[model samples]
Target chain A: MDLLSNLSLGFATAASPENLLFCLIGVILGTLIGVLPGIGATATIAMLLPITFQLEPVSSLIMLAGIYYGAQYGGSTTAILINMPGESSSAVTAIDGYQMARRGKAGTALAVAALGSFFAGTVATLLVALFAPPLTAIALKFGAAEYFSLMLLGLVSAIALAHGSILKALAMVVLGLILGLVGTDIYTGAPRFTFGITEYADGLSFVALAVGIFGIAEILRNLEGDQDRTVLGTSLGGLLPSRADLKRMVAPMLRGTAVGSILGILPGGGAVLAAFASYTIEKRLSDHPEEFGQGAIAGVAGPESANNAGAQTSFIPLLTLGIPANPVMALMVGAMIIQGIVPGPNVASEQPELFWGIIASMWIGNLMLVVLNLPLIGLWVKLLKVPYHVLFPVIMAFCSIGVYSVNSNVFDLYAVAFFGLMGYVLLKLRCEPAPLLLGFVLGPMLEENLRRAMILGRGDPTIFVARPISLTLLLLTLAVLVVMFLPSIRKKREEVFVEAD
Target chain B: MKNITVDWTDAMAGLIFILFGLLFGVQSLGLEIGTAFRMGPGYFPLVLSGILLVLGGLIVFSAIHDRGGEGVGKMAWRGLFFILPAPIFFGLTVRGLGFVPAIFLTTLVAALASFKMRPLWALVLAGAVTVFATLVFSYGLGLPFRRFGPWLEF
Candidate 1:
């Protein structure tokens, strides 16, 4: 009854005429960017961060949330039509989805992806409503030691979850931490790495770093290849799934929701991990495992559901504890900060309407995506036909404007260029920027808590071990590290990533 | 198998990290290094640099043990040339030339990065983007910037 009443309050806040209009606008724009390859929710959110300053906090949040899950829906559309993934999470969908398109079952695959995602979004919204209260309660009890240990766990899990060399990921994390320390010290009046620049006193601009790395670097990477994209014809066969398809989809969708709901709660786990993990789980459980990469309906159904579900539930940590589980959630933390809302344990008790309204808006956004995207699949496909040459300049122009608007400082634009080049160099070195981003987001928190915990323990450094919750988190971090190094499990993890790639 | 050599890219990446670590460590030496209970500005950074050095060492060592599969794929030299400069041009010109002309010039420069771009088409594209951006951002969003700058004053 308490949860029901809270949800009703959420609905009341979210269902206002203004909120609904913004939500619709948000989903449509989200789908537009998501349908366009090389642009992602992370970049889109970064670009739109300044606009949120103009609206009511609740409506702005609802719109951003719409963009997040709306991208998840639109990503699968491009995956099915073109062999290219519009978003990284939807890369898994492209394998079987593209195959289905080639075989004249594109309409059925799109329908399955849409329906499955809708079902998963509904379940995950309820899960968020159920779990957030309890998680916040646990978060309230966390001390400096527990917070430090939890961050360690988060960093380790990010490395364990990321593809490629763990050492490189570790290096990236350390580098990010160093870069984050460029500002003036929190405790002392001394500057750490400002190099006498006045703008460096506030550390790097998050929008610049994000737009440069994810947005600008990605555009550069995409431009490297020739523009030879072939779409699986405009004829989207029958949009309805057969009775057999429906029956097969049922178990996978339910299982995907379960897996996504659980994993999405973890610090390093989010929509991408949930999708890939669910796809692997479904393949293992399916009797026709061989059909997985060859247009199997279950292949499209499961991962799509899992990614949507995970996207919804990933809001849990951010909303409750102010800990971002992934880069997208990290951007959300930036948004929250921009709104003058301190993202932490007290948010639920402090801002009940804002908290629940976001949850309710997610459900509404999901419904809007299904309604708006199904008929507009053709439109998205047409968008894909727009060549990279024209599209990229427009993207770059917006990026410039977005970066400039952040602080209205020309210095930030320079930072964007610096990071864009740095990001490109990192990409050349075969390093993934995702884990580095998470590390950057969590860096200041980790350092502050580490110092605080040590001080509290009177420099003994055993306070982390003495506290039960802290010890447990540290142990989990250790376990993740050990498991990542294990040859057998390491091989399987590599295989999973390779398959998705 | 083809003669396996040290993974040069991995080695170089590791070297770059180690260099960064050393630089940070040396820089932190100038700052106050207080006790663990009461860390100064330098304490956390020094420790992080130490860890980075160790990680960088490990990566370099691992590079020696592996068969070099591929070097950094073909450098997006053209992309680097255009994309990196486009933003810099915008930053330099925005205050002097104003948002519209600055955006226009930036787009034109960026469009030239693509070999397929025709001069006429690029000009039209730039004009179209500038007008649309002016309408949306300058007018609709009211992002206070002059449509024409002091430099245009005759």
Candidate 2:
């Protein structure tokens, strides 16, 4: 009932041999993908979603969650070694991390990143355990109007934080919502966008859409560039950090953890924001900010810890409210739906084992990452050498097989190919697809809630404004939109993203 | 006369979105769009397409005044040639050719897209992938598919 007992129950569930084995397999596979270039955690998770259909809901979630954070750790490896960030969250790390490697501190940089990430993971796991219950209690009070308003806020914030033209991101959200409508209408039973195809009746396959956009499109994009990278350091000099390094890193890691824990709870704020914010905060708070771009230990420590912490806590909104804050969380929501476990406030009460099991497994996953990566650094580096040219065929094959297995239908494969081309075009046009995926995931819920709210209000749209919680959420959405459009904030947003680029 | 250039990336993107919005709007028009209190299937989509059209218009307007962004990069036609066809070929052949031959042919075709791959190496790589795939997907995972199709008569 309480936090300690709840976690103990989680431990009991997670500690079983089967759960541990799957968790280990997940983190290992995650680290592999994370070290490799081109593909990322989102694509990897989408490819693996079919496998989750075979396993228990809790084990599958544990494995998927492992991949999310495990990639964070693996991403830092490439960032430090090759200056190619394996994941976007690790982009900031590549700044000083690559610099540190050039200065012959590659081992030290890696040791700090792994240790900081582990510490942050532990703190965040506890934070989730402590915070999830109260959040669910609040979410339980939400009516359809409130839920609708909340999704509106979520959608708007996602648009606001997206790293491009505000107008373009907004369009992508609308486009995603439109795509989500490609199935039998929930209310009237009349088909909306199936185009008279039977497969259309059920709706577009999530796996097909996701793999097409992220996986196949990524292959096309990668093929345009040269398939090569040069690692800076051959020898990883002295793996242990000096006392001075440890002293300087401790404060930054703690601050990063604190910053990440808070930001990760906000809609659309995840590893990327947490890492960037931590770097900026550390720079401002530092006595010698000049060391930041060069090879500041704090720069590497803070962002690494923050990103890991941010990735962990991003689960909160998805678990508590069933509203995904970002693309990865959206995929997790899809995974839950496939497992037939509806994700919402009631999940904690109704499916206590699954809820707590996943939380506990995260800490275990983090521990495994530190242990597994510390020893297997050499292996991951070799994996980095697997050229994109040879690797893509294998990736495509896996995607085709995984997607086909989902429905045992050829139509799904064709959908993947179609979306892949669409995804490539969208990418070329500089439109981000992450927001589109989120919009698709949230579309049905948004429509259902909006219709319900409208009926309850007897056609008066004021119902959204009449309820206190719903009113607050709608106002928040308006506030985000207003602030996003403000010239100064818009300029500031570009500046933050540009620095990483 | 001084030369003037306009970025087409954003413009093209805007044009595409506008066209999609119009298409959806036209299609939704055929369906019954109910009132606010009790909506039909078309109500949400009709409203969404309208928003999309407006947003696309805004993008085009912004692009008209915009000075500079990168022009569209060269399309990877070569990549498209091998990558796109490989899957389609597999899909078309997998039923008759079976998983092994279908996957092997697919991999070989896909491998040729990379300039680095030689014919001999492609053959070797395809063989490896096909064997590995058949082993994992069919034997290990027990995906219900015949390894050899009717054409093989085995």
DockQ values of all predictions? 0.76, 0.68
Per-candidate local distance difference test:
0.85, 0.86
Every candidate's TM-score, chain A alone: 0.96, 0.98
Candidate 2 chain B weakest ten by summed lDDT:
B1-10
Instruction: Return the clash pairs for model 1, or none.
Output: none
Report, in order, each candidate's fnat: 0.72, 0.58
What lDDT, from 0 to 1, does candidate 2 have?
Answer: 0.86
- Candidate 1 lDDT, A393-431, residue by residue in tens: 888888888888867888888988898988888878877
Clashing pairs in 2: none
* Model 1 misplaced stretches (Cα beyond 4 Å): B1-4
Q: Compose the digit string of candidate 2's lDDT tens values, residues A183-282.
A: 8888888988777788778889888888888877888888887458676646777777899999999999999999988888889857888999999999
